[model samples]
Target: MNTRVVEIRNPATGAVTGTCQGPTPAGSCPYAGRDGVVPCAGRLVGPAEGDPRCWPVWVPPGCRQCRITFNDQAVACLRAAERYRDQWDAGLHRERERVRALAARKDPRFRGMSDRQLQVTALWRWRLSGPAQGLRHAEQKQRDWGRMYLALAEQQRAATPPVVVGGAA
Candidate 1:
């Protein structure tokens, strides 16, 4: 999306903590986005009541459509400055490390790219490219399947003899 979203996770377990963890209480991230927080990936735990991922024990946390889209001005800010890390002062070495780590979390492919490489070739563009590429692949696959189904239907029709009632008497 055009904005950044932080999936709030349990610090101890790394499992998504969900939006319900927040205030009106004494403790919460001071940086809650203007857009708000995403709900925990797990809420209702079954197909009869809600989601299938919550079932069969060993329940894996999967994304649901009901995510709270917290506005990501902070992430956008970091993304703007990240590609220029190679030129940042030596004092920013720790910041550079932090930013690279964050980028990798977004996509593992980012790990191979140096800051200069990111800037020169526009890593953000590449990051955006991945999802579009997947969409293109899906569209191509669907088209192939549709045509195959059509051909099969046509062949079946051709093989069937026409039903003639009392017309030739």
Candidate 2:
């Protein structure tokens, strides 16, 4: 479906900042037009619950039918975004678990390394066996995960209770 949208751009960089889709040519609603009744003012709304994607929609106090229609359209977009997000999260979780398994399989030679280090090392090991460029994307993913892993590890370490090896000091 061709949804006409106005692209919001950054003034300095001239990059697309965001977009707003509307049902009318004027790019807004709740206005007088050839259709006589343009319904309540429409605008793009989102970063809504369960999704960060926006959708062209109208709010209440106008035609009940129009309001329901707009809301249903918005809900459809949000649901689609939610599904994609769920898949992406699941994939990341699986990848993290796989990395953890790989770390366990390593021998004592890697015993002192942190889990994040082991993950990056594992990626590098794979890179060594293939075309360098082919593993570039995977390497980048590993680096991003490494930073996240380290931050989580730091938080966990800080939250842990100190051990009392013998007796009270």
Per-prediction count of colliding residue pairs? 2, 0
lDDT of 1 by residue, 57-133 (tens): 11124532322211122233344344333333232444445556666687565667777754534433433555544
Lowest-sum lDDT 10-residue window in model 1: 50-59
RMSD of 1: 23.3
User: Candidate 2: global Cα-lDDT?
Assistant: 0.42
Report how far off residue 84 is in candidate 1 (Å).
34
Best prediction by lDDT: 2
RMSD of each: 23.3, 21.1
Off by over 4 Å in 1: 1-128, 167-169
lDDT of 2 by residue, 79-137 (tens): 55455445544555555566667557875656667977866765555445434433444
Supply candidate 1's per-residue lDDT for 18: 40
lDDT of each: 0.37, 0.42
